[model samples]
Target: MMSGGNLSQYLAKSIAVMVFGSNDYINNYLLPSIYSSSYNYSPPDFANLLLNRYARQILALHSVGLRKFVVAGIGPLGCIPNQLATGQAPPGRCVDYVNQMLGTFNEGLRSLVNLLNGNHPGAIFVYGNTYGIFGDILNNPATYGKKILHFLN
Candidate 1:
């Protein structure tokens, strides 16, 4: 992936940029199931794992020459229309535990970005803090602007 971006500079002379979102499958689905929880149902731990993996990927990308890109980490999955639709039951409210996971993940991402920038000279990794931006919208539906409410139902 890094090499492709590097080489694209000559063909089109345009910087080939790639944005990676959500290391969730590895962190949220696989790690928690295998290491933290037995039934594969815990959401908080899964969220943490997702964040950790994201940090690692960012570091790996910086290690290479693919430093002229941004990484948009996981958004507020709890408020996502899909999760809200699926989680509408007795406790139809958005899951706090899941949100917590997102918080941790964002924190880790911020730290990783700072670390990369501080340590590496020409590192251009931008951490898009989507969680903080969307948290309020999730809490206050009336304040929602032109955002599309994602609904699985």
Candidate 2:
């Protein structure tokens, strides 16, 4: 049970930030040193599994009163410093395979958000182009007001 008030009543006026999906595939499945998620679950089927669960969660949130949502698409996991340090990709490039998976997941997430908006009345979902944003920062930090991408030695 909610403490302050009814969920639907409270959510009716709040903006929810939805950011999820990444670790399971990246750290767990994709990384060679970690658990093998690819062996257990393929991308297409795993995406479906995630969507089904995510939809239930969103609907639950909507049932409580949430009407507006800012859903952040997963960023470029392969381009992160740690991943780069792992030697999977060339020093100056992002891991294409991991990034490809993230892209596919982002596409599915976008579709899911659209589907949720269609099912729930008055719900607004804004898909943040985090992937694009991250890419810009990586390829050209100056565009986002930063001078350059500072790679650590």
Candidate 3:
């Protein structure tokens, strides 16, 4: 218990950055490669399941001590180089299904964040629009473009 100056201040001011939803939804639920979870739940139902779980985790943190949370949603999952390399889509294009599913998942995540912020007192939950930012970059690469990259490479 080394409270040199004030440990309560630090604990009270703690901010949690939760960046998830891509793996659980994309790898386990959305991918067509046949994941057990995917077979068990439909797209929308899977999105609900993921969002519900994420919200529970965030609320648990909120209940304990932390308040400010930066909850980041999934980006354009199917737009990566690997999906493009499947040869199923035209060059420099992404698989539409995965991207669409990601968007749906993001909507649920954003709504959950909003609901959490409303329910919790003095809790500041900032929903990180990861998908929006990446979508903008992909759509207008010249404006906001960076080479070399992600799950693809």
Candidate 4:
């Protein structure tokens, strides 16, 4: 369940910055409520559920005069370096099915944003693309000249 607790804190604290990110799988297939236990719908059947829900939430917030929010769409999950490294196939090969799922999720998110923008005059929803940035880093880590390592410290 997505909560507005952080947003409330931001409003109270007068914070001007907020950031959000979504995992590839989540962005694509899971956002829709169809995948939810409350709904026994399949992936393709629940295609646009997530986007529609997000739009509704945005509109509800806007009705209360809460504007200025950022929502990010998912990125290409199939191309992550972790996926590539773990594969026994050729280099740079991504999992097509996973990417397709993410594509669906992003599509839904974009549709939701469009619906909110079109219906409400004062609604402010900024679409951030965190997936692309992370994907770029994963693709070419050396370009940033920073080595990322995971260890038990």
Ranking by TM-score: 2, 3, 1, 4
Which candidate gets the maximum TM-score versus the true structure? 2
Tell me which of candidates 3 and 4 scores higher on TM-score.
3
lDDT of 1 at 98: 55
State the lDDT at 104 in candidate 1: 58
For residues 57-82, what per-residue lDDT tens digits would candidate 4 score against the true structure? 66565654466767776666556554
TM-score, cand. 3: 0.83
Better of 1 and 2 by lDDT: 2
lDDT scores in order: 0.56, 0.76, 0.76, 0.55
lDDT score, candidate 1: 0.56
Candidate 4 clashes between residue pairs 3 or more apart in a chain or in different chains = none
Compose the digit string of candidate 2's lDDT tens values, residues 1-153: 876567557778899898777666666666645666667677777766776777787777877778898888879888877677778887678887778877667888888878877777788988888998888788877777757745722
How many collisions between residues are there in candidate 4? 0
What are the per-residue Cα lDDT tens digits for candidate 3 across 32-115? 577787778877888888888887888777766687899998888778765666666665677788788776678888888888
Order of candidate numbers by lDDT, starting with the best: 3, 2, 1, 4
Residue 115 Cα positional deviation in candidate 4, in Å, after optimal superposition: 3.3
* TM-score of candidate 1 on Cα atoms, chains taken together: 0.60
TM-score, cand. 2: 0.85
Candidate 1 structure quality by residue, lDDT tens digits, 1-153: 547665544333323243443445334343453564425545555555656766677566555445565656666666554556555433546645556555655676677778777887865657776776666655565666665463422
**Model 3: runs farther than 4 Å from truth?**
1-8, 30-34, 145-153
Q: Can you list the residue pairs that collide in candidate 1?
A: 81-150
